[model samples]
Target chain A: MIKFSINKAFFLQALNATKRAISSKNAIPILSSLKIEVNSQSITLTGSNGQISIENTISAKEENAGLLVTSSGAILLEANFFINIVSSLPDITLDFEEIDQHQVVLNSGKSEITLKGKDVEQYPRLQEVGTNNPLILETKLLKTIISETAFAASTQESRPILTGIHLVLTNHKEFKAVATDSHRMSQRKLTLDHSSDNFDVVIPSRSLREFAAVFTDDIESVEVFFSSSQILFRSEYISFYTRLLEGNYPDTDRLLVNNFETEVVFNTNALRYAMERAHLISNATQNGTVKLEVINNQVTAHVNSPEVGKVNEELDTESLSGNDLTISFNPTYLIEALKALKSETVTIRFISPIRPFTLIPSDDNENFIQLITPVRTN
Target chain B: MIKFSINKAFFLQALNATKRAISSKNAIPILSSLKIEVNSQSITLTGSNGQISIENTISAKEENAGLLVTSSGAILLEANFFINIVSSLPDITLDFEEIDQHQVVLNSGKSEITLKGKDVEQYPRLQEVGTNNPLILETKLLKTIISETAFAASTQESRPILTGIHLVLTNHKEFKAVATDSHRMSQRKLTLDHSSDNFDVVIPSRSLREFAAVFTDDIESVEVFFSSSQILFRSEYISFYTRLLEGNYPDTDRLLVNNFETEVVFNTNALRYAMERAHLISNATQNGTVKLEVINNQVTAHVNSPEVGKVNEELDTESLSGNDLTISFNPTYLIEALKALKSETVTIRFISPIRPFTLIPSDDNENFIQLITPVRTN
Candidate 1:
């Protein structure tokens, strides 16, 4: 039997980290259990699938002196319930002991629970990535890039390649992230201090979403390791691994424009409010189009649905350049882009009636661009 | 053309109350619009179906010096979009004028909007209730009574009467609210200062829900006007009307037990936590039974689901009276009852295997009582 005591605070942190390790719907029963083992100085928790495994360890303390280990053993417990109980328990030493080959005792203060366990040998093995192949980037910057561009990725299962954000590192100094659903596109650019040989990868948006949850603002750098089909992100004490999406991304450089026939700048808040109002009725229709009419110095947004009626609003613009233009686009695309914008004023450029429009921050300091294709309105 | 200037704040508030007046999915187009009319002292907004209508009036203010009313007329504007636009606009004096027979102009500061309006004659008329048969109750007390008991009402549409709480005046000064779903039940009693003739009314849960949203603690008494088929709750500024659910309510007094075979008393916190843990897995099962085994000074809660797993928790009880009993009940009902409990300790009384169980505050306050029927486990 294996018996040991763990510091409640340290154990909770490690347990929460490994909690994400277990799959909610694992086909194999053994893969769902976390393998916990006690060494002299630390306790290791391993949760794994056949492809990916996460291992976390918490150091033991002096107050846990009486902790004894009769034999080294492994057990598997239900992930969801065990985490719920441990998180709610008061800060106190936790006792873990193996009563039999398949049973383990978990006790803290007045609470004692006995749960069935699985054999440790059934746990999947973790892949080893050489330290020489790691690339480092600021954690906050990485989080910002993911937040800005991931929402534009296609959620439909038909286009599996569009579900991944294409990341390209130019000479290891500048990084770019791009996501598109064919109709709408978003891109974010940032500069990195480290230089690794040139690299390119397509990480699934779902995995980046999970990484965003675990990332905090304080961490300075995150080490990224990539193998053929899997990528791992390592922060200070946590490592997140996800399977990479496989396919060739479409070439999108031809979709961008260098010049525009008309450019209109307006406060983000005003445009957002106008689109929100238009969406109120347009949302009932199939395409949900909102028409924007920009003349010399004014812009009017018009939304009409045969079933719900119509709404037309005139908004003050900061400035307008070039010839007059009329464009109709999906209001949802504009709303999402406005929600992600960080600047007070945004400049939208229109090239032609059939071409896509480009939305960029009015201030030149921000390196983000969002492009939206205009829908043909009847 | 109808023209008026009103305070945006007052307009937004009145608009909110009026928006709720329209039916969510009404067949008549004008029934889904709010009828607005400008008079000398106030702007009245009426939203109605054929049976019910909410009329809210915002009195003119000193700022009305600039406000102009050219003509007194009524127009119907789409409730959803109009409310959203009015709320998002900056707080300022708003100018509303009819541009044509079918369009209206809404302008405030630099923002101008033209919305298509429907003919007001198509809107449904508000039902008038006689003021003679009105019952008075404290607004706060009524809100509390509804919140506590309404959640237990049956959500199934088969028994329409069960979807409403039965409100009956036992004496001139005492009122009772009772709701049940056959399996679980909740009842609350309140004392009134003024005496009224004996009365009973069944108000739909939906109307009570709307009142809960708008009711505040500052108001003292709300006058309730009852007709043959509709009930109206009148506050100082707002009148709420709801269609009564037809059919006779079940007699639940006999379901209450006068004595118990065994009573188990325990701290509310301990039992609540145990039940919550058990509920995590029990929620997945059909009947979701959580068995309670009480012996000596201990209570054990056992919840099991063949597909997910099981949870067993032992709780220390203050004391147990009479014969030892093992009872199974829905943990969700028990959890909700415990949350509504006012006392720190709760005493549960058991009568028989298939009979209802009583859960009362340890203190001998008869104002609140909750009964839950036990589900037989195989």
Candidate 2:
């Protein structure tokens, strides 16, 4: 039996964090339950959906937790139903007690709720990732890296390997993260002050995104551990675990372009607005395309759909050089790349009208770059 | 040629108001376009989807409109496309000009867009609602009345008459609006200061809800006019028109019960909170029912869902008299009825466990009342 009283607000927050990993539809009935274990000093809540699991612990030592435990035990309850009940409780503090096997009662003010609990033994045990050698990084830096590269990952299951972001640590000093969907690629590299064994792993893009969303500003840094088939991202009060994709990532080093016949510089905001307007028309056409033309020092972007009319705009370019060229490509790829760059000014280098192009921040080093393959418009 | 220059923000607002009536799919091709008529003094934009139509006019006399008409003419443009183009323009002001018989050009900053225009003569004429005698009421009052009675109307189409709210002006003095869906009913009555023609009509609940949404606080009063098959609500700068439902509304006067064996008074907000909590569990069950018991002047609300558990709460009642009783009902109906009441304290009078009950504001005159039928659970 388990019995405890805790602050409503504090418990609700913990439940929400763990709820992110709980999918509504569960292949295993017990997987839809949330496992809650209470000890003399703390309470832990765990929720899992097979692919990903989240666990949050609130320590009694923390003044705001307001935790009082009469006994120590573990139990499981329906995830969504329990959360809603807690959310609708009327008082500041709620008392929980397990009077019999598979029976639990909750009292908050004049409201009393009784729920059927599942057996804790029925839940799958959480996979353990070895923490012998952990990689430590700033939470904000990790969030930024995920945002910059994850969007390029393929969403289709046909190429399962491309649906994951590749992370590699080389020479125990350099770290890099890359994602690509054949048509576009994003790479981010950074130097580390301290590292352990060099390893390479592919984490599913969806799992990485979820991990980044759960990271709050108060979590200054996170520790990551990798096993053969599982990865864990751990903070002070939370642990996030996900299964690693079992496949080799494609070699993307040779895909980066160096030689260029045409180059242009543009204000990020100005170019984005023009692309958005052109997208309005191109988006309506079948296999729509937005074309860009460079003449002398002026550049113009235009989209023509016979049925919906046409739109043309003079781009606000910062500078231009090399041979003047005209190129047509999918506008959506460039728009998303620009948003991820988060820069004031961007530099674009093109090899040919048909070759892939590269975009980099004009004010920073080339450590971060994105590549987009142009469409062959004849 | 139709040519004009106007402030972008002012024009966008007008387009949005008119766009509310334009449906994505239209039986008549021309109905997908918005008609624009510009004279020397004003420009009117109209959009219709057969059932309802909305028109907004911008006058040159309004300083903020910044309307500078180069010429007076009329034309039609695809509603959604034109709205999106105007929204994406970069400058504060946009210039529009008709270059040919079926083509138009819009210039804003460095962006130029050309769109195909349709003949304005192909668009259906706006049905006129004679202004010979108009009944005027405060916009706020009309909004309140719509909210108070519209939710009780039936959403199902099998009974067409119940899907509309019956509005009647008796002897050109008393104004009453009532709606019922067989299981529940809401009625609101008021007196008009000045008299007009006595008439009765049934307006579709959906149209009134949409018309109410477009009314802003700036519109102090609305003038309403009724025709044989249509009704129009007109303000100084905007007009909304909708077709009336053709059917005889069922008489609901006999459904209102005046005597009861049990009476209970409760604070509206406190009871609503309890009901919401009870609804959480009852909502999960098939054909869920929430049961309320009154005994010795104390009330308890409970819901028992075998699979999801049960919740019981002691309600904070203001007063109780008469007899003890227990009743079961569909919580959704009561929840919605309470929301529409918007009262501080409500008095609930029950005739019996199986008979419908009435709720009225305990502190104010009985001008607004809502009745709910009980669910029979043996």
Candidate 3:
């Protein structure tokens, strides 16, 4: 039997952290439940959705936790239902106790809730990723890398490998993260100060996104461990684990272009706003294309919808050079890539109208790049 | 030619207010467009979605408007598209000019948007609800009436008349608003100090909801005008019009009970929270029933879901009298009714197991009352 009382807000924080890994539409019935295990020193909450699992621990040493334990045990309760009960409790503190035969009682003020819990033994064991020689990554830097690349990953299930972010550590000093969906690709590279084990792994984009979100301001760094099939992101209070994609990521290094017939430099915000307006008009058109023209050192964007109307806007470009050219492509892809770049000034290089164009921050072009394949309008 | 220059934020405010009446799924193509009529002194924007129409005017006299009109004319442009263009413009001020046949050019800084405009002459005329003998109502009071009763109206369109809130002004002094969805009913009554023409009308619940939402904090009073087929809600700068629902509203006056077998008074907030928890549990059950037991002056609420779990909470009741009783009900209905009451203390009257119950504010029971028909559980 397990019996404990804890502060409501602290408990809720732990529950919310674990909830990111619990999906309601799980194939396994027990996977939809959250596992609560209590010990003398701390309390741990775990939630899993088969592909990923998150464990959050609150120790008794934390004063805000207000934790008191009479016995220690583990139980699994329906995640959403239990969350609702705790959220609506009338008091600031909650009392939890395990009764006979997989039943738990929760009390807060005058309200009492009795929930049927599943045996913790029935829950699938968390994947054990070996922790030896763990690579240390700055929490903020890792978050930036995930945000810059994960959105370019394929969401469609048909190409499962493209749905993962390809991560590589080369020469124990360089870190690279890349994601692509054939039409567009984003790559971010960072240099490390210290040496670590060199490894390459493909982590699902969803897991990377969730892992990045789990970081709080207090978590300075994350320790990453990679096994043959699983990867772990461990911080001070939370452990996020996900199964690695088994297939090899596609080779996209050759796709990066260093040559261009024309290049235009733009203030990122100005171009993004113009592209947004163009997108608003193109969204109503049949083909959803925004055409751009560079002439006499000036840039203009045009969107035409025969049924609705059209928009022609002179884009704010810092400078333009090389052969004047006109190109049309899907505006959504470029808009997303620009949002991820979050640069004040970016330079876009274009070859032919049909070739893929690349956008990189003007100050740091060598470290980050976004490439988009253009559509042939003929 | 129609031409004007105005502040973007001021223009967007007018667009947003008018956009409430424009639904994209409108059957009439022109109804999806907003009509802009500019005169030397003022600009009026109108949008209609067949069911309702809203017109907002911006006057040159308003300091924030900064409106300047070089010519006076009217045009109709796609509501959503035009709004998006103006919203994303790079500058604070926008210049609009009708260039040629059915085309308008809008310029803001370096961005220029050319849009196709429908002929203003083809736009439908606003319904003429006679403004003579208008009834004046406190905007805050009318808003209160809407919130207190509108939710009980039937959302299903099978019985069109039942989807309206029946409003009656009797003896030129007593004003009452009532709505019922057959399963439940809510009634609010107020006495007007000034007299107006006695009238009875049924306004569609959706229109009343929209009308209430249009009121900003600055609007203190609304002038109401009623015609045979349409009702108009007019404020200083906005005129809201909707067609009244045809057919007679059902008689619900007899449903209010003056006699009861059991009566329990409760602190409205405490009861509401308890019912909310019960609702959380009952929502997962097949029948969604919350049972209430009042025995020996103690009240306990119980919710049982065989598949999920159960909750038994001792309620905080002010006072309970009459014989012992056990009643099961759809907790959602009571929860909504209690929320609408917005009263510190409430008295709930029960007649029998199968009969309807009534909830009224303990302070002013006669002015407002909510009646809910209990579910019959054998």
Candidate 4:
């Protein structure tokens, strides 16, 4: 028999954390529901699609914790139904009890709901990543890095490995992440405080997003475990797993250049907002081109569509040097890269109008670099 | 020449109101833009999609009124581009100047944008509903009646006239609005404060929504005019016109019946919330089926899907009377109708399990009656 009075907050958190594993249209029948194992001290909920699995636990502790399990048992509930019902319940203590091991009932105040359940025997077993010591990392830094670079990954299947965020740990101290879709690329690097074996792995960008979403604000640290076939992330309240991409990642070190023919410096907000106005007319069929004309002390943005008319914005710049250059590019790529920048001002270096340009945050941003190829307007 | 210094708020309101008449993918080139005419007292803006035309004029009055046109002239500006640029400008005064008869410039603070213009001579003129005195109706009441009945109209085109809301004025005082899609029907009536001659017409539901959107909170009454081909709604700031449906509407007086074999009275919110929970498992293929079982003093909502499992809940009721009847329905139909009800307590009267039911608001509901046919669950 299983019975418990769980606080609404904890139950809702666990349900939402595990929901990323439940797809709207799960092709696998067994993957459409979640498994809940109840015990005297705590309760564990696990949800999984074929590619990833997430397990969350609510412990009985603190002055007034969210859960209290009296008896121990296990059962399966349809994920979508369980999520909707729990979300719509009143904001108070909720009582959950199992009857005959095949059904469940929930009650709060004047409302009581009974839902049919399935035995946990049919739930597929999750693979274990072994209990040996795993590499520990700060959850906040990892989450930030993922947000900075994962968006640059290729969404097309032509090059499967390019769809993953490649992580490289050199001599167990220097950790770097790189993502590219051939046209534009973003990379961020950091020095890990804890030492470990040298490792390189490419995790699919889609899985990284789901893994990152389950991190709570209170979860400062996470233990990372690695197998030949998959990567696992274990935290105090949650465990996440993701499939590894097969094949070698391209070496992007050669693409990072330190020299330039012309360089322009401008406040990130000023340039970004100006581009947005120019973007009103710079849509895709028109090549999404926004021309930047660097002359004297200003950089003017010009966008002209044959059908929609023209837009011109002269943006204020700090300094414009070297051979005056006029270049164009898809404004969307530069806008996103600039938005990810952490500095108030940014330096953009160009090598003629045909070669790719590099964006560097003024002395403030620590270890991230972005590059974009200019679209030829001439 | 048209030269004016206008504030951003007034300009935004006029642009958005007219945008509703401009389709995103209009085949006609002229229909994609808005016509702006400037005068000393007011500025007029017009947008039309051929099917519907909306004219909004901003007058100089009251504190911080929307417009103060300085000169007299007219031109057409691309709706999407103009709206986007004006919306992004800072909250301050903006200057508009016509130049060379074929171009216009907008200047605000440090930004100046030049856009090409079209001559008003080529613009299509809207058909006038004549200068004869039009009927006056309370904007709130008309909006309320439309909301209650328009949703029941058929969205499909098999029967063109059923997609309209039929309005009838009997004895020059009582006005009734009725809409039906064969499966369900809704009717609402009220006595006009200002008496008029007998009138009846069917207006397409799509056009009624656009006409209602132009109403402002301060405007209590709107003058309505009718022509053989169109209906016109004129307020202090806006004028809206729409084409009338060209067919005779079905007479629905015989469908309204009195007396019933079973009836249930409960708070509208209580039943609506319970049905929403039951909806998690109810959907169209299963007929969007949710069964309501009425007992001595309780009503239980039950939904069972073989693939997704079952859900059952007992709802609180004020009173349950007559023979016990178990009726099932497409919860969406009943939910929408109940949401439109204005009273706290709602009484549902049923003739039989297979017959249609009438929904009447307890005490506060005025002049509105909704009907829904129960789906036979075999």
Clashes found in each candidate (C-alpha, N, C closer than 3 A)? 0, 0, 0, 1
> If the candidates were sorted by their TM-score against the true structure, best first, what order would they fall in?
2, 3, 4, 1
Using TM-score as the measure, which candidate wins?
Answer: 2
Model 4: per-residue Cα lDDT over A1-378, one tens digit each: 789998887688789889888886878887888899998888889999978999988888733556777788999998887888887675478888888647888886555667778889998887777646688888988898888899889999999999999998898899999999988999998898888777799999999988778886689999999888788999987899888899999999999888898988889987787777677778723588889888775677788776666666777777778888889998888888889887889988899888999887877445888999998875
DockQ order, best first, reads 2, 3, 4, 1
Off by over 4 Å in 1: A1-78, A81-128, A281-287, A297-314, A375-378, B18-23, B26-31, B47-53, B61-70, B90-93, B281-287, B304-312, B352-355, B376-378
For every candidate, the chain B TM-score is 0.92, 0.98, 0.98, 0.94
lDDT of 1 by residue, B272-331 (tens): 877776777677677888888877757787766655555667777777878767889888
Cα deviation at B20, candidate 4, in Å, is 1.3
Tens digit per residue, CA lDDT, model 3, B219-253: 99999999999999999899999999999999999
Q: What is the lDDT of residue A232 in candidate 3?
A: 91
Q: For model 3, how does the per-residue alpha-carbon lDDT over A1-378 read when each residue is reduced to its tens digit?
A: 999999999999899889999998898888999999999999999999988899999999999999999899999999988998899999999999999888998999999988889899998998798789988989998888999999999999999999999999999998899999999999999899889999899999999989877777579999999999999989978999999998879999999868999999999888888899899889988888999998888888998888766888888778888998889989999989889876799999999898999999988978999999887776
In model 4, which runs have C-alpha deviations exceeding 4 angstroms? A1-9, A62-71, A88-124, A131-133, A363-366, B1-5, B27-29, B60-72, B89-122
Question: Tens-digit lDDT track for model 2 on A173-246?
Answer: 78999999999999999988786678899999999999887878789999989999999899988999999999
Model 2 score (lDDT): 0.90
Q: For candidate 3, what is the DockQ?
A: 0.73
What level of docking quality does candidate 2 show? Answer: high
TM-score of each: 0.87, 0.98, 0.96, 0.90
lDDT of 4: 0.83
lDDT of 4 at A69: 78
Clashing pairs in 1: none
